[model samples]
Target: MKKVYTAIDDFKKQGLDMEIPLKLLMFTGLRNHSLSLLKVGDINWIEEIIVYNAGIDNSKHKVQFLPIPPGLMAALKRYIEENNLKFNDNLCYGIKGIPLQNKQLNRITDKICWDIVNQRTFNFI
Candidate 1:
């Protein structure tokens, strides 16, 4: 399980500067599909909340509200400022493209978590 502390440590070590989404997912325990549909507007930084506006195309649920911790919110704000993230229409664009599709995002996230778990297990051996 990618909990807060582990996620934060991994974020720091990755140095890829794409830690906000990872932190959000780890902290909130959101489904990857729900996360994929998130826009910058969905986040209420002042109130420390993330509104899951709706589920992705194939998902069942429509919407949900997730509480954002101060630490996670702060990190997200910093990431936006550092990256100059612009809110385009209803999307948050990153690096090379618009927000990723659920499958792509899930694969990336799963790889990170798997790597962390594997490394920890190896170290304990």
Candidate 2:
């Protein structure tokens, strides 16, 4: 049988760029606002988890540990190391290198573009 992560296969096929969060959304059911709050430091490499610490100013749903599969965790580790990302850096950055916002995440969905033989250009989201 297919698994929860299997739902993200389509998004993975699209590439591992800015669109990756869409796959995470499907897996975690995390609201865009919550995901946006994530920072590089929130990730706990030893625990294999992503920590989301909700500030007092924010509403409920404070503090969470989202597990990362071994393979994906490895990928994240590599990306972080190769990019020389720091703890204060933002975890999610869009194609234009801007912090990913809720509106932008909402727009992250299946998109079809009219290029060569109806190529699916996901740039719309």
Give the alpha carbon lDDT tens digit for every residue of 1-125 in model 1. Answer: 44535654654564433466566667777866666667777887777898876635656665677898888788777767776766643233332456756776665556656767666421110
- Residue range 1-125, candidate 2, lDDT tens digits: 13323324444565536434654565556788877777789888899888877866555656778887777677677767766778988777654557778877755542321222354333333
**TM-scores, one per candidate:** 0.66, 0.68
lDDT of 1 at 95: 24
The number of clashing residue pairs in each candidate reads 0, 0
- Among all candidates shown, the one with the greatest TM-score: 2
lDDT of 1 at 26: 70
Candidate 1: regions farther than 4 A off: 1-15, 55-62, 89-98, 120-125
